[model samples]
Target: MSMQTSIALGKQYLLDTYAQVPVVFAGGEGMYLIDEEGKKYLDFVGGIAVNALGYHDAGLSAAIAEVVEKGLLHCSNLYYNTQAIAAAKGLCTLAGMDRVFFCNSGAEANEAALKLARKFGHKSNPARTDIISMVHSFHGRTYGAITATGQDKYHVNFDPLPQGFSYAKFNNLESVKALVNEKTCAIIVEPIQGEGGIVPATVEFLQGLRELCDQKDILLIYDEVQCGMGRSGKPFAYQVYGVKPDILTTAKALAGGIPAGAMLTCEKANEIFKPGDHASTFGGNALAMAGVNEMVRRLNDPEFTDAVQQMGSYLREKLVQLAALYPTLCGEVRGMGLINGMVLTVSPRKVVDACFERGLLVASAGYDVLRFVPPLIVRQQDIDKALAIVEQALASLL
Candidate 1:
């Protein structure tokens, strides 16, 4: 089918919610996507950081095929599925948490976390209900998740939002102190704020919050939905700062492209639910769990995680070198792992369009921040090639 036909059909049938580009991918390989007519593009966006292992990974394909051959997709919440149980155990073991609640997406995982925290707080004290979040932090698009996000742009359209939500400054301790109160149930934060220009929290800031949560008897929630599952060069980003959360919500690459997520908690916090305090209809389906099981096993490997760390360092170093050469377009780069962004005074949107035209798929976090979240399995040579494309696109702007 022609791209125009596909777009026209979408315009007629689909909701006008997304500002989609002109490109429509036909299929994807390891790190490349082909258009309907067979124009290959090097994909660095990774489906907006969702495709962890890139497209059509062998292991992931095999896992999905096996699950399909078994003839199980949506095994309802009645009986236990092998994939769900094994997937949960894998996440629990990797996260060093007590239990897990699997779900279909990041927003769902975060919603589950919010529900769990509210219940835990009420269980401890009925009046303790309010939750704290940092400004500019992007959680998700759900009603509850939108309310929890500190950005006003997301909150402007959705009024009468859920009460008991507060905001504080990022990377500042005094702001967090000012927001905490007796009614506060939890504080949700992303260790490295992804959508907010890839800004990372200070070590002292995270450690201080941990200590404060310990003293104030409040649940510490880390929304690792974007930064977890080997995106941050570790099984979890919280591990890098030597801090742990009472509730850690993860998604995105948890299933390496399968629609899956998880909510993890300490042993004590796991007791918030007895037999059935909360559940999801399609939370831990057999197919999603099978994919998740494979992803979890691959990520749990030390060598794989170490390679991610090395790739991240190499990419960042290359960025720094380019910055030195071209200070006009490239301002600076910052991130924990493969999730890095290059700050610029020029419009990143234009750069993104230029890269797209050059057959390099990337994304922009903010107006001036060109974000680069390549697949974890992207090779060093691929990084060099991507940088060359970025360099060409950036030089044109200069």
Candidate 2:
């Protein structure tokens, strides 16, 4: 009947993978979630950057309602649905790509990208199936994604991972260049490294990769799982870098809060996946598309995206000022658009716990950086309210 009772039941059923907080949400409205006791918390973390439009948005709610009213949830990937088709079209058109493949999550999308790359290369050389991923990049927890992800924390326990995966240094073009050879199928990167401490790829580095990929005749993949769909104040972070990838994977904010993932690629690369090369039983279903379409439409609007850009700047400025107040504990802030990080000179988990206690939600990246990937719909004042809590939390750290 109570939140604690419900959480206890959940732990018994769910895997003990996540170190969850003690609060539970009964319902949520724009950037705020109410616990069963009716206590409200400012949701700056935005469901770990998945709620691009925040919780229970009217547009998203209406879309889901309308679709459910039509008696279609799991339409499968057999009969085509307009909702999915429209979403795929809108996504490709916005990203300047030719085709789109829908899945379920960011990790799934990245997994799809990996398969696409391998298949494309295997078709051409059959031997050149190797991939080069950057160190510290968080692709996903799936077998292929985990293999591609360069972090040891996720790699430990999952031994004998898929071969043909190697790591290079982040933001260092030379590191990537040194790894590329005849067997390299593609080089995957996140334009702005989201889970890797909110580090943005240098413009020169991205451009250099583009050129290198072109010269080597290898596919270039951009994993915009955390930095896409107006989160970066741009449709995609690749736009900011002026570099285009042969394959682009997106997911986190695709359906606002709904589970959806997409892999977009240019025309030449799109042919790699044949009729039965890949398929997800639940991919591109009508219900999921309803949510994805609404989110994409709303976020693609200039007014909404412009607001995200403006608010991101506003939030970053406040963080910079706050960081100045705590020189010893807080380091410089980094990142682009709303997906910024507060570089902490101390432990990130302590600050995160402190924020949670103060009725604010924040997430940590790597180990020492605090990330803020709030909903694009969040206003400047709500950000200020969240920042106030952040300031207080840092002050208490002293």
Candidate 3:
């Protein structure tokens, strides 16, 4: 279908939630998307960091095709599936955690994590249900997850949010300390706040939280849904900080765009959930687990992960240069690994729109930051091209 036709159909039927750009993607090659009009645009957004290995992945495609041919798409939780078992083992090994509970998305993974936390809390005391989340942290859109999110904008019109969620200032140990008490069972944080403008937490802050959580017997939940899966150039962002959390929630890029999420817990919090406490209907189905197996294999490789770190440094350096060249238009650049953001003095949407017009796809993180979460497999030339397109887009604003 033509781009205009597809867009018209979408406007007629789809919800009016997103202010979508005027383009319809037909297919994707490595690191770029081909629009219905046959325009090649660099895919720096990576479908909001879902396409970790980029488009046209042979291994992932082969695995899915194999599963399709078997005609065993789902067997429910009643029967055992080899793919699910293997995926869980691989994820646990990579995460250095004891067990994993699979789900469909980041929000569901987080919801499972919260339930695990509350279950663990109630095991000791009935009233220990409070959860402390960072001030700007973006968890998810589910009732419990949205209630746990720190931003008030998402809370609007969703009145009577679930009780027992308090907000603490990001990177402020004092703010966290003030909100803590006997009722606080868990403290959820993003090692690097993704939607909150790609902000990274300070080392001292994370270490302090570790110490405080230990003292208070609180579970430290790192929402790695955005920064994990080799996006941070490390296996997980918490590893970069040399600290670990009691529980971790991850989803984006987990199954290479196959819609999978996992909530992993260390030994301390691993066995909190009984069979009847929590479960997902199609969480670890064979098809999704097939994708997970392939994706985890690629991301767990040392050479590939090292390249991600190197490329992240290269991308950050180029962004720093761009900021220096256009100080009036840009602000500070933040983030680690491939999930970086360029702060803008102007509205991020304006800059994103300009870049889209110039054959590049980017996204906005918070209110004024342009987020760049290219595929982990993006090459140096792709980075150079994306940088050039961004520079041209910024120059157009002048």
Q: Which lDDT tens digits does candidate 2 get at residues 162-250?
A: 99999999889999999999999999999988888999999999999999999988999999999998888888888877889999999
Question: What is the C-alpha lDDT profile of model 3 across 215-309, one tens digit per residue?
Answer: 99999999999999989998889988999999999999999989999999997797888878999999998999999999889977899999999
lDDT score of residue 329 within candidate 1: 73
Question: 1-398 in candidate 1: lDDT tens per residue?
Answer: 79889888888998998988887788999889998789999988998778888888999999999999988887788889999999989989898788998888988889989988899889878999899999999999999899999999998967989999999999998999998999998999999998988888899999999999999988889998888989889999988888999999998888888888889999558888766877888889999898889888898799898998999999999989887788977898899788999898888888899999899998998567889888889899999999999889888888
Candidate 2 — which residues are off by over 4 angstroms? none
Error of 1 at 202 (Å): 1.6
Clashes of each: 0, 0, 0
What lDDT score is found at residue 380 in candidate 1? 95
The parts of candidate 3 lying over 4 Å away from their true place are none
Model 1 TM-score (2 dp): 0.98
Displacement of residue 48 (Cα, Å) in model 2 is 1.1
Q: Which candidate comes out best when scored by lDDT?
A: 3
Q: Estimate each model's TM-score.
A: 0.98, 0.98, 0.99
Worst 10 residues of 1 by lDDT: 267-276
